[model samples]
Target: MITVSNLTKRYGSVHALGPVDLEIPRGGVTALIGPNGAGKSTMLTIIGRLLSGDSGRVEVGDLDVVTADSRELAKKLAILRQENHFVARLTVRQLVGLGRFPHSRGRMRPDDVEAVDLALEFLDLTPLQDRFLDELSGGQRQRAYVAMVLAQQTDYVLLDEPLNNLDMRHAVTMMRQLRRAADELGRTVVVVVHDVNFAAAYADLVVAMVDGRIAHVGPAREVITPYVLTEVFGTPVDVIEHRDRPVAVYYH
Candidate 1:
């Protein structure tokens, strides 16, 4: 489990994130939902040890994310940031192979190759394996990045807006892949998502963050209501039951 205690951050005077406590369990999909600038990325980045917090403690399983060795943490937790930029051109297979660095240490063994192939297959990128990142469309590139994180074979996976460049079909496919990673592979998946209906459909738990604090944390049914949506987003929302899932609708 990922345990967070009194996590807080500030940008000079502005309070960017909490003194908030949260527990992210293993083997399930927990969707972090909130408006822009809601600090979802902040929490994820801090947990990944890519950024420092003003004050707080974060532990992934038994390892303190802050104190764990960089290579060790990379082996245990894989994070895919929202914005992905490729400086040096790399083929799809090369980028996915990089995920094995924590385990392979730049020496690609047979096991590493197998893992890379699995990740590419998982993201349905086998056909694009030899294609350069710059040659793929946005959604295809996004899938390639996700495959890279998956190849890390970590127990904890943190994805910031995994659906960013995906279209309707790809969005659904990406969420389903995440769901399988949790249910079948026994990996914990934490994602920050903007689409309320997608969160309602795919996530086991929905965490609502607003104004740098956790407004609500519960099952999707409870957090995906019209009242919670309106309260957190300050916009009128209508939620209706559809095939046993809550669907949010909004119209001006």
Candidate 2:
């Protein structure tokens, strides 16, 4: 399990995040949903060790995120930030191959190759493996980035705003693929998503944040209710059932 205790981040006197505690279980999809600047991204980045938090501890399994070795942490957890910038032009296959660096250290063995191939297949990017990242659409590029993270084969994966550039169909496909990654591959997936409906449909748990604090955390059916959502989003939300799942209707 991923555990957090009294985590906090500050800029001067302003609290960007924290004094927060959360525990994400070992093998399911957890979606963090909230308004802009609600600390979802801040918390995810801190957990992934890309950003440091002031005054608390974050543990992925038994390893302290603040103190773990970089290489060892890479093997234990893989994260894909919302904005990815690459100076060198790389093909889809080459990018995915980078995930194996923790194990192969730039010298890919058969197992690493197999892992890359499987990740490409999982993301439906096998056909585009040879294509340059610039050649693909935004959604396709997002998938490629996700494939790279998946290829790492880590026990925990944290994605920040993974649906940023995806269209409706691709967004659904992305959520389904994430769900599969958790169910079939037995990985713990934590994603920051703006769309509560998608979270309700795919996430095993929904963590609602407001102003740097987690307002609610529970199963989708329990947390996605109109009262909770409306309170979290600061807007009226109507709940409806579809496919035996609760979907929020906030856009009027």
The TM-scores of all predictions, comma-separated, are: 0.98, 0.98
lDDT of each: 0.93, 0.95
| Candidate 2: residue 37 Cα off by (Å) | 1.0
Q: Give the TM-score of candidate 1.
A: 0.98
Candidate 1: which stretches are off by over 4 Å? Answer: none
Measured by lDDT, the strongest candidate is 2
lDDT of 1: 0.93
* lDDT (tens digit, per residue) of candidate 1 on 1-252: 999999999989988999889998888999999988889999999998888999989999899988988889898999989888749999999999999999999999999999999999988999999999999998889999989999999999999999986899989999999999889878899999999888999999899999889999999999999899999999999998999999999875
TM-score leader: 2
